[model samples]
Target: MTSHPVRPVADLFAADGRLKAIPRRPARREALLAHLAETLFEAGRTYREAEVNEALTSVHEDFPALRRYLVVGGFLARTKDGAAYRRQQRPTGTGGAIPAVA
Candidate 1:
């Protein structure tokens, strides 16, 4: 598959890692959210819903939306009962750069 090009996260987020605004382009949005997901979660680890929310809250005030973006962007996996969450082994994203924000 030809990977979609992505702009730097600075083009999307504020200095604090909060999304300044959602990108209109799907490719850029997915790339930016996928980068955000990796920063908030770790490989080989699982999280409870509350834990995921707490972590996402540090990055954005609208944690639920952020969580949905992460899952929908194929960067995170969640259980059907919504009890568990984890970074997926292989995100079906365009494989873009990880953001530099903390």
Candidate 2:
């Protein structure tokens, strides 16, 4: 349930479905990041740190940064112990852009 109605930035990706660059604009980046987040996870599914990283690896070799984007962009939530991650359930029209931290 995204306010965005669509990803809105398909041009940011390459033919292989990997991002060409991380957008500097939050709106564009967050939208694309949201799409990337979904590919790495399923709704209501919980993943281990390694599992999350493995999934993100499909998009970027810098999996850690991608993971951080998902977390910071409010697409995923992580435990303090850093063992698990979960896809967030956001309210429709909220745009899923709330940062998990600050």
Candidate 3:
């Protein structure tokens, strides 16, 4: 099977700044999630689940999936009770760069 090119994060969105689509490939999705985590959540601040949903919904209608992906992708962390959320300082093993999709 052939691999897909890694599109720039900007290309994932429409001219209006909303995400046009969520990527399916792991590397591409990681890049998008990292971008979203950085832009949407402030560092060193805790957020309510409703707040996270609001922020995510501003970008995409499917906030729940985005929320799930963010958590699963390690971009966002939530309390055991699921009432709170916070952006992780950084995703592990990224070396502060988005890995290329290959």
Candidate 4:
């Protein structure tokens, strides 16, 4: 029988010595909008288009389009001044923002 060589323990350690797994969740449009709305509302501040884009940058680089989609989808409401958007409080009977994609 032939024997295989074994690797040393030191060789198995990565530079950081930590194994990292990427998150499996595919950031959905609706979830992103809901999270943004909740964060802004909790902060008691309105978010401008640029601010919204910046807020979502870590999740997706195409945040401008995503923001527009959220606006069109009714997850967020554009202010009358057209300078910012606000998270619309869901209707009393409504459950929550519908999931857009998995």
Candidate 5:
């Protein structure tokens, strides 16, 4: 069996003794946007750009584009200070129909 070379743990440590240069996978923009949209939709409420930005800070450092996408997609309504989003309800055909008196 061939022996594998192993680097010393100290070699990976930074001056502060923390692991240095550990790589992490980046978040997918599409997936992050979808999740944000779904979260807002399910909540049945609209959040301001700032609020949305704060909420998505973990997944996306830049939220301006995401906010714009949501507004354009009709998933969220935006305003200067905040936003108000309501689910689109289907109209019931009860207009002009008189109710029968029991």
Candidate 6:
């Protein structure tokens, strides 16, 4: 199986592990959103808006933007009423390894 390229998280965070700032580049921002979604939430667990805010704020002060990005990036799904959120499953690659070429 081929593995996906992992985005580097080292430069995006400070010594305390808080994000230095929300990334302006789309790729970088998407990586950040995925990291936040995976680390801050559990799959199949529903979180209220306040709970999400609290978890996000522990890492960065701008919780709203992070929340919006997570939803927009399809990393986190929200209820129609905007009352709850869940972490979507990480996308998988191809089911099996490719055969080696001679």
Candidate 3 residue-wise lDDT, 16-99, digit = tens: 889888888888989999999999999878899999999999899999999998877668878877888888866477544422
- By lDDT, highest first, what's the ranking? 3, 6, 2, 1, 4, 5
| Clash pairs detected, candidate 4 | none
lDDT: which candidate is best? 3
- Per-candidate Cα RMSD to the true structure, in Å, reads 7.2, 5.4, 6.7, 13.3, 16.6, 10.0
Off by over 4 Å in 1: 1-5, 91-102
Q: Estimate each model's TM-score.
A: 0.74, 0.76, 0.83, 0.47, 0.41, 0.79
lDDT of each: 0.73, 0.76, 0.83, 0.51, 0.44, 0.78
Q: With candidate 6 superimposed using the best TM-score fit, by how many Å does residue 18's alpha carbon deviate from the native?
A: 0.7
Once superposed on the true structure, which residue ranges of model 3 sit more than 4 Å away at CA? 1-5, 91-102
lDDT of 1 by residue, 1-102 (tens): 788666687777777667777777777877777677778888878789999999978766888887887776667778777888878755344354331111
The better candidate by lDDT, 1 or 2, is: 2
Give the 10-residue window scoring lowest on summed lDDT in candidate 5: 21-30
Deviation (Å) of 91 in candidate 1: 4.9
Candidate 2 vs candidate 5, lDDT winner:
2
Reference-based lDDT, residue 49, model 3:
93
Model 2: per-residue Cα lDDT over 25-64, one tens digit each = 6778778777877766898777899999988887778888
lDDT for each residue of candidate 5 in 1-102, tens digit (9 for 90 to 100): 655454443454467644343223222333333445665445556444456666545444445655555555444554434444432221234342322211
By TM-score, the candidates rank as 3, 6, 2, 1, 4, 5
lDDT per residue as tens, model 4, 1-102: 555354333332246642122212323334445555565444445667677777655445566765665666556667655577666664433344432211
Candidate 6: give the clashing pairs. Answer: none
Give the best candidate by TM-score: 3
Which 10 residues in a row give candidate 1 its minimum summed lDDT? Answer: 93-102
